[model samples]
Target chain A: MTNTEFIKSLSEKTGMTAEQLEPMVAQFIGAFARELASGRVVSVQGFGNFESREKAERKMYNPTTKSYKIIPKKVTLNFKMSATLKDKINS
Target chain B: MSDKVTLQSVAESFSRACGVPKKVAEQLARAFFDTVVDGLSNDESVKIDGLGTFRVVEVASRESINVTNGERIVIAGYKKVNFIPEDGLLVSNLVSDMPDVREDVVADDEETDVSNDTDETDIEETSEVDDETEDVSEDITTSEDEEPIDAVEAEVNMVEVPEKVEVQEDEFSGIDMLICTPESVEEIRLELEQARADAERKLIAAKEAHREVLRLEALLDKMEKSMVPECAEEEQTPETEAEPVPAMVAESVAKENLTIYEDIPSVAKEESAVETADEGQKAEEVAQTPVEPVEESLETVETPSVVETAEDENVTVNLEATTEEPSSEQEESTDVAPAEEDTKSAAEEAVQSTDAEVKQEDVTAEGAEENKDAQAEALNRLLSDKSAATPEPVRKKKDDGHYWIWILTPILVILIFGVSVVMYKAHSDKEKTELKQLPVEPKNHATPVKKQAPVVKPKVETDSIQSNTNVPAETTATEPAKSKAADNKSTAKPKTYILQRDETLTKVSRKFYGTKDSVRAIIRANKFKDPDNVPYGTEVILP
Candidate 1:
C-alpha cells in the first residue's frame, strides 16, 4: 500500500485520527523495520520473525523463448513461526 | 500473494483505503496493537481464529545463554508473552465481513492461498451447497454403489468430512446399514443455515468487541503519551467518547438494518472485507476510550448551568487566545492582501481602534490630574484669605469707603453750598452710625447667605449630574463627597453666646468664648489676683 492508503486503512481499522496515527506508525516502523531491511533477524517469543536476506544476482535462461537475463540482487523479509505458534496451528 | 507489509506501509495504506487521515490511521493501528498487548498482559486469549492468537506464555524463569559466547545468565521467574498472528486469518477476518473493509485483505488472501491451495477449491464446494442439493442426492446414489459409513469407518479411525460432504443419515433404524431419508436432508439444510447465521452473529459481536478493545487501547496510548500523567486511567472505563462510537455505530447500523433489510443484497467476500475495515475503526475508538478523563477538565464553559464566574473566565481566556492568534494571522493576511486596498483599510481600522482605547485611558488620567490641581488651588486661596482677614473687621472697612462715596460726598457738597449745616451734620452722623452698626449685625445678614449657599449647591450638583451622565457612577461618587463636606463645615459653627454684667469674670468670659468654663482660663491668661473681690470693678478680661 502507498503511505496515504496505508494510513487511511489503519485509521479505519483503529479509529484513530490521522494526526495522532502518523507519528506513532512512523516511530514504530522506524525502530524495528530498519534492521530487517539491512538483513537482520527479528525474533519474538510467540510471534513470527521478520528477517532480511540478500539473494545472489544470477542469470537465468528462459526455457520456452531461449532468452537469458540477469536477475538483480534484492533483499526480502522472511517470516518464521515460533514453536508455540506452530503447535497451536497443528492442534 | 502475501507480500511484505511493513507496519509503516500498512498504517499508510489503511489510512488511505478507509478514507481516514494518515495520522489517525497510524494511531488506530498502534491502538489495535496495544489492545492485543493488554489482552496478552492480562493472560486473556486474544483469538482471531483465522488470523492468529495472542496469549501470555508463562515462561519458567531460566538462565539465559549469550548466543555468541554461549554463556548462561541468571534469569528471573515471570510470565512473558508475545503477539502471534494466526497467519492472516485474524487480520484478514477483521477486514472481512465488515463493510468498508481495507484492501489489505488481498495481501492476507494471497498468503493463505499459497499455504492451503485446497482451501479456495473447498470454498467453491461449500458455496455450491445451496445449488448442489440434487447433486448431493446423485452423489448419494453413486455412494450407495460403494461401501457405507460403517465400512468406511472400519478403514479409518474417524471419518473426516472434506469441505463439502456431510453425513446426513447417520441414525440406524434396525439394520447396521445407515439409510438415507428425506428427514435427514431437511435436518442438514436447517443445520447449515443455523450454523451460517451463528457465524455471522459471532463475527459481528467479535468485531464489536475487538473495536471496543482497540478504542480503549488507543486511548490508553494517548494518555500514556499525554503530558499530564493523571490523564491516564484504567482500561475499559465507560462514559468515554471512545466507548460510544462503536456503540453508536452499532446502534445506527442495527436501526438501518431493521428498516432496509430487503434493500441490502447478498453478502459477498469483498463486501465482508470492507466491513472488517469499518469494524477496525470502531475497535480503535474503543481502545481510545479510557483516556477520556482529560475531557472533564476541558471545563466546557458552554454548559448552561455553569456559574457566571467560570463562564467569564473562559470567555476571557478565549478572548486572549483569539487576540493573540488573530494579530499574527492579521499580519500575514495583510501582507498577502497588499493589492487589496479595501481589505488593508479594514485591517488598519481595527488596529486603530485598539490604539484609540489606550489613548483614551491616557487622556482620562491626565484629566483627573488637572482636576485635582484646580481643586487644590481653589482650596488654598480660600484658606489663605480666611487667615489674612481675621484680624481686621474687614467687612466694615470695605463698606466705609463705599459710604464716603455715597453719603459723605453728598453732605459735603451741601455744606459747601451753605444750605443747612445742622441737617447735613445730623444726616451724615446718622449714615456714619448706620455704617458702624452694619458690621455688628453679622448673624442677621448671614442667615440669607447661608440659605442661598444651599440653593447654589443643589444647582451645581444638578449641572454635574447632567453633564457627566455617561461617566460611571463610581466616578461621580467623589463629587457628592466634596459637596457634603462643604455643607457639613458650614453647619458646624458654635451658635450660643452670653454677655457679662458688672465686670464679673465668668459673665465676661462666657460672652467672649461662648462657654462659662473659660473664666478660669481668662484669670490664668491675665494673672488676676483676688478674682471675686478686686476683680468686681477691675475690668477683668474674659477668656
Candidate 2:
C-alpha cells in the first residue's frame, strides 16, 4: 500500500476527512523524527522500535585505482519489529 | 527526551504539535501504526510519504551446519521487515555533518588533560556522557518550539536536527559503547594498554637509534680532524712534479709499513731480487758505453739498502736518472718488464701475509722509523754517485727544480689550508645542527607522551562512569572540587581573578590558561569540594 492509500484507509477508519488527516499525519511523522533525532528509541506498541545507530568510519580500497578512501562515520536509523507484530505478520 | 519514546510520548508530541486533544491524538497514533502493520501484511510493503518504505523481504532456505553439534541441517527461511529511509530525510544526510563532530570531540579531548586515576577519568566520562545527553535534550526542546510550518522549513529543521544528533553521537561514541555492553570496556582497556606499551617500546628504540647515529657522526668528525694535519704536512714537502715519484714512493712505503709490517721481511727480499735484475739489465744495455762499471757498482751498493728498507725510492730515482740520460731510455723500457713482474710477486706475497697477521701497531711504527732512516742513507749515496758521474749537469738540474718548487709551494699550501678550513666549518655546522636536533627530539617525545596521557584518560573515565553511576550527585559535587584545584594551580603560577556569578572552573580555566585541564589544579589550590557551584564572589588564583 502506498502512502495515499494508507492515509485514505486511516481517515475512513477514524471518520476524519483526508484534508484533516493529511496534516495530522505530517505532524505525527514530524514528532516521530524529533524523538529519534534526540537519540531516543521510539517504540510503537505491537509495531517495532526506531532508533539511530552509529556506523563507525572504515577504509575502502579501490582495486582499480589501487588507492584507499576513508568512509566517514554515519548515523543510520534502524527498525526492529516487535515479536507480537512479527507473529501477526508471519501468520 | 527520555531514554525511550513509547507510543504515548509520540502521541503526546503529536497532540502538542497539531494542537489536538490528547485522547484523539493517542487514537490516531495507534491507528497509524496499526494501518502500517496491516498494509505490510497485505501488500508486503508500506510507503510513507515523508518517512520511508517498509518492505517484507523473502529469505531463501539454505543448508547449514549446527554450531554445537557440527551436523548438516536444512534451515528454514522466513520473511523479514526492512526499512529504507527516504532520501530527503535528515538521517540520510547524517554523514555530511560528521567531520565537524569529529573535530569538536578531538579538540575537547586535546584541551582536557585528564588525570591518570582510572576512577577520576571514569567519573569524567560519565559526566561528559550526561552532559551530551542533556545537550541533545535541549536541542530537541528548542527544535520542537521552532517547529517547521512547511515542507521547506521542515527540511531546514531536518538539516539542523541531524547536525546536533551527530555531534552528540561523536562526543559520546566510546561512552555509548561502554554503556551498551559493559564487557567490551575491559577488552578496549586491554587493547589500549597494549598500544601504549608498544608506543613506549618504539620510542625507546628510536632514541637508541638516534644515539648510535650521533656516536658514528662524532667518530667521522675525529677522523676528518686527524686527516687535516696529514694533508698540511704533505703540502709542506716542496717537490717538483718529476721528483714527486720518489716522494710518492716514500709515502706508499710509509703507508705499507703502517698497515702491514709483518710482511716487510718477505717484501724486502723480493725488492732485492727486483733491484738486481733491473741493474743487470741496465749493465747489459750500458756495456756498449764507457759508464757500465760505474753504473754496475752503484746498482750493487743500492741493492742492499733497497732490501733493508723495502722502499720504491731507489728504483724511482734510478728511473729519473735514466730519463735525464736519453741513451738509457731504451734500457729503462727493457728493464720495466722485469720490474713489473718482481713488483707483482711482492704484492701477492704482501697480500698473503696481510691476511695472516693483522695486529701489532707498535711494531709497525718502529719498522716505519727504520725504513725512513734507510731511505735517508740511500738518498745520500745516490746524490754522491750522481755528483761523481756528472757534477755540473746535476747542479744545473737541482737549480731548475728548486726554482719551480719555490714558485708552486705557497700556492699549494694556501689552497690546501683553505680546503681544510672549509671542511672544518662544515663539520662544525653539522655538529651544531645535530645539537639543536638532539634537544628538539626530547620535546617531540614529550608531545607523544602528553597525547598518550589523554589516550589513557578515556579508559579511566569509563571506569569512573561504571563505579559512580549510582552516586551521580556525589560525583558531580566532587567534579567541581577537582576542577577548582586545577584552576587554583593555574592562578598560583600566573595571575589572580574574582569568580563571577554563573562562571565555572572550566570556563575560567579556558579564559586564563586556554585549556580546561587547569581547572583541577585551581580546584586543588582552593580546596573546594564543589568549586563549580561555589559562591559568585569567590576569589580564584590564576597560574
Candidate 3:
C-alpha cells in the first residue's frame, strides 16, 4: 500500500480520523528510521521483535578496475507487518 | 520498553536504533519480514494474547553464525513457525467481523510442556545439594518436581503421627498438617525432635543389618572350607587304622573272588612299567625274560604280592578314574573293583603254593582236592611276602636293569645288522668297480693287431736271406750259394729252432764238415747271431 493509504487504513481501524492519524503515522515512520539508522532493535507487543546485528565492512572489488575497495557500512530501513495487522488487512 | 516500534516498522527501527549499516539493517529487517524467523531466533514468542499468535518455533538448530568472522548467518534450511491472528485483531471499522473466529486464541499448550523452564538463576544454586542427596536414593525414581525436599517432608511427617501405633503404610500421612496452639506446636516440636532421633536410630540399624549379612556369608564360606578337609580325613582314617578287620572280612569273601589270578600277563606288564617308571628308564635285556617268569611266579608265590601286582595291571581302572574325575559314586565303584581283584589274586596265590606242597606229599590218595586248596594258601602267603619286599629294594634293582635293557637292545641289534649291511654294500660296490675296469674291449682289439703281422712276414724273409749272403766269409762259390739257398729256405719256412746233438761248437763244425770258425757261420745261418748268449741246450741250421 502507499503510505497515505496505509495511514488511512490505520485511521479506519483505530476509529480515528485521517487528520489525527497522519502525524502519528509520520512520527512512527520517522522514529523507525532513526532507530534503524542507529542499529538498535525494536520490539512490538502482539507482533514481533526486531534486532540489528553487526556486519563487518568488506573489501568489495570494483569489477572494471580489477582492484579491491572497502565497502563502507551503510544503514537500511525495514518494515514488518504484524500478524494482527495482516489479518485485519486480509479480512 | 517505553516507545517500542510498531509491527510495520520494527525491523526498520532495530537497525536505526542500533546504528548498523543498511545491509545489516536489511538482514535484520528480512528476519522481521518473516515473523516466525524473528521470534524463533530471539527465543521469544510474539504472543498477541487475544489474537492468534506467532511463536518462537523450536528446531534442531535455531541459528548459525560464522564463528571466525562474527557474522550472523542464517542456518540454511527449513524450520517450523507460523502466525495466527485473533478475531479482534482481524476486524474493526476497517475490516469485516467474522463470527467463526474465536474470541480468545492466545492460550499456550502447557499440557505439552515437559518441564517448567528452569531459569539459569535457580539451577546453579540448587543443583549441588540435589545431586548429592539424589545419588544415595537412586532407586526412588523421583522426577524433577519431587526433588530432595521430599526427604525433609518425610521427616516432618514422622513427628505428627501417633507414637508406636503408626504403621509403615501411613509413613507420610501427616505431612503439611497445622498446629492450633502454642502448646500444640511445642508438643509437635518435641515429637519432631524425637522423630529425628528415631530415624537416626533406624539408619544405624539398617547399616548393622547389612554388616550382619556380610558376616554370615563369610562364616558360611569358612564352614564349607573347614568341613571339606574334615570329611576327607574321616574317609581316610578307617581305611588305614583298621586294616586287619578288612583283611579278615576279605578272607571270608575269598570264595567270591577267584578271577584275579586269571590275568597274569597284564599284571606283569604293569609291574614292569611301574619299575621302569620309578627309575625313569628302559628295557634291560636281562630283565625281559626274568620279568615274565617273575610275573608268573607272582601269581604262584605270595598272595598279597600277586594281589598288588594285579591291582597295578588294571592301571586303566585307576587312570580312568583320575582322568574322568569320576563322580563320587563312580569313583567308589572303581575302587571297589580293584580291591576285590586284589583280594582274589592274593587268595589264588596262596592256594597255589599250598596246593604244590600237598602234591609233593602225595596226598593224592586222601583228599586230593584239598591239596589244591592248600597249595593255593601257600602261594598266596608267598605272594604277599614278595609284594611287600618288591616295592622297595627289588623295585630299585629291576628298575636299573630295565633301563639298560630297553636302551641297549635295539641299538645293539641295529649295530650288528648295520655292520652286516655295510659289508654287503661294500662287497657289491667293489664288484661293480672291478667289472667297470676289466679288459672287455682289449680282447677284440688285440686280435686285429695279431692279424696285421702276417701281412709283413714275406718282406722280413727276403731281407734275412740277403743279410746272410753278405755276411758270408771264406765260403767257396758253390758253398756260399748253397748256404744262401739254405738261408732262403729257412726264412721261407716258419722260423723254428731245433736242438742239436752233443757236438758242441767244436764238434758241430767238424761233424758237419766245417771248421769251428764255421760255427759262427752256422749261428748266422740259423739267425742265432749272438752265439755266445744263445739259449742253452739248443742248436740249429748247420750250412
Candidate 4:
C-alpha cells in the first residue's frame, strides 16, 4: 500500500490528522531503526519482530571476468512475523 | 536500547523525541503498526519509506514426509511475510553502530590504518626534530660567530647538519628495505646452505657405506672361491674309492658287501681286505673246503684298497692296470692284484685248496661259512655308520651358503635403502638450493652494477663449496654461477618459492615486493591453473 493510504488509515484509527500522524510515524520508524541498529530485537506485540544480523565478509568469484572480489562485511535488518500475525494473514 | 525493545519502549522514545504525551505516543505507535498490518492484509504488501517493504509471498504447496510416521503428506500453500529494509537506511545506521557492537573486526582495520599513519608520522616527526636541531645549532653558531674566526666554523657546522640529516634519511630507507626483503633472503640462504651441507654429509656417509659393503662382498666371494677347491680335494678320495669298490665288490662278494659297500665302500676297503685274508688262512687250516669262498671274499676286499692306493699314487698307472687286469690274470695267478687279477687268483686258490681238502672235515666247512656271514653283517653295520658320517660336511657347506645368503640379503637391502635415502636427500637439497638461489639471483640483478661484483663473489664461493662437497652436483652449481653473471646485465630474474602452510601466491608476492601487485606476475610466471586453491609446498616462481 502507498504511504499516504497507510498514514491516512493510521490517522483515522488514532483520531489524529495525517499531518500529525506522519510526524509520529516518522518518530516511530526512527525509534525502531535506532533500536534495531543498536543490536536489539524490536517486537511489536501483535505484528512482528525486527532484528539486525551481521553478515561476514566473503569472497565472490566472477566467472565471466575470471576474477575474485571480496565482499565487505555488513549488517542487515531482518523481520520475523509473529505467530498471531501469521495466523491473521493466513485466515 | 534494552535487549528487547517492545512497542512501549518505542513509544516512550518517540514521545521523548517529539515532545508528545506518553499515552498519545503509545496510541500513535499502536495505530501505526495496526495500519501497516491492515495494509499488508489488504494489499498483500506494504512499502514504508525509511523502513522496509513487507511483502506477503505465496508459498507453493509441496509434498513432505511426516516426521513421526513413515507417511507422505502435503503442506497446504500459505502466505509468508518477508521484510526487505529500505535501501541504505537500516544498513547505514547499523554500519555506523557496528564498531561499538563488534570491536574486534573494526580493530583490525583500525590497526592497519594506525600503523601506516604512525609510520608517516614517525618519519615526519624525526625530520621535524632534525630540522629543529639544525635551527638550534645554526642559532648557536650565529650567536658564536661574533668573531670573524668563528664565522668560518659556523659555515662548516651549517654544512655538516643537513648532510647528517640526509645521511640519516638514507640509512632509514636502507634499513627499511633490508628489513623488508634482504634479511629474510639471507636467512633463507643460510638455511639452504645448512641443508645442503647436511645432505652432502649424508651422501658422503652413504657412499662410504656402499664402498664398505662392496669390499666385504668381494672378500666373501674370494673366500668362497678359495674354500671351494679345498672342499673338492677333501671330498675327492672318498668319491673315487667309493665308486670302484661298489662295482668290484658287488660282483665278487655275492651281495655280502652290497648294502654296506654301496653306502661306504671307500671307508671299509682296507679293513675288509685284512679281515678277509685272516679268514682265508683260518679256512685253510680248518678243512680247506671253505678256502675258495674265503679267497673270493679276500680278493674282493683287497682289490678296492689296492686300486684306491694306486689311483691315489698315480691315476694313469691305475687306469692302465685296470685295463690290463682281465687279460693278464691267468699268466700271474694266486697273487691278488687290483682288478680281474684278484678274482682269477682267488678262483685258482679255490681250485687248489678244494683238491687238497676234498675228503677233509665237512662240519668245519659249515662252521667257517657261518663265521663269514656273521663278519659280513658286522662290516655292513660299520659301513652304514661311515655313510652317515660322510654327508655332514656337505650339509655344513650348504648351511654356510644359506647363512651367507641370509647375511648378504639384508645388507644389500640396507644398502639400497640408504643409497635411495641419500639420493632423495640430494635431490631435495638441489631443489632447495635452486629455489634459494632464485631469490638471491633476482636480488643480485636488482642491485646496481657496482654491487654485482660482490654478489658474484658469493655465488662463486657457494659454487666452490658445492663442488667440494659433491662432485656430481658441480655441473648444477656452475650453471647458477654463470646465470648470476648474466643476471647482472639483465632485468631482475624470477625467484622461486615453496609456498608454506597457509601461504598463498599473494602472500609470496607481498613478501618479495612488499606489495601484492606482483601476484598476477607470479601466477603468469608459474602458469598456475588454480591460483586461488594452490596446494601448500608448491613451487612458485616470483617475477
Write model 3 residue lDDT over B1-543, tens digit each, in one string: 234544445434433433545454444334333443333445444542222345433345447778999998876443334444333221210111212111111111121111112212223333443354322111111222133233323332333232233323113311212122343245346546545555454444334333333443443344335434543452333211112222222233433222322233345445555543432222123233323333333323222222343334323233443344323323333333333333333333333434543332222112222222333333222222223322221122112222345445667899999999999999999998888767555544643323333346665345434433432322222333333344465442223224443335544453333245666767778776566655545746656
Top TM-score hit: 4
Per-residue C-alpha lDDT of model 1 across residues B1-543, encoded as one tens digit per residue: 224455555556445534556776556555555554444445565653222345566656788898999998877655544445333222112212122222223343343334233323332343353144321122222222122222323222221221112223111110111112243244345545644554444344334334433443443344224312211221121111111222222233532321221122122223433433443354345423321221111111012112233233333443343344533323322232222222222322323324533343233233223323333332222211211111011111112222234445655786777667777888999999999998658635653333343457775444433323322222222334334423442232122222223446664443334456766876786676666654333444332
Candidate 1 docking quality: incorrect, acceptable, medium or high: incorrect
The DockQ scores of all candidates, in the order shown, are: 0.02, 0.23, 0.04, 0.26
TM-score of each: 0.18, 0.30, 0.17, 0.31
Q: In candidate 1, how many Å is residue A1 off?
A: 30
Chain B TM-scores across candidates: 0.16, 0.21, 0.18, 0.20
Task: Write one digit per residue (lDDT tens) for candidate 4, span B285-329.
Answer: 643454446343433433433344433333333333434542232
DockQ computed for model 2 against the true two-chain complex using alpha carbons: 0.23
Candidate 4 chain B weakest lDDT stretch, 10 residues: B330-339
Chain A TM-score of prediction number 3: 0.63
- Which residue runs of candidate 2 sit more than 4 Å off their true CA positions? B92-543
Better of 1 and 2 by DockQ: 2
Specify the CAPRI tier of model 4: acceptable
Residue B539, model 3: lDDT of 40
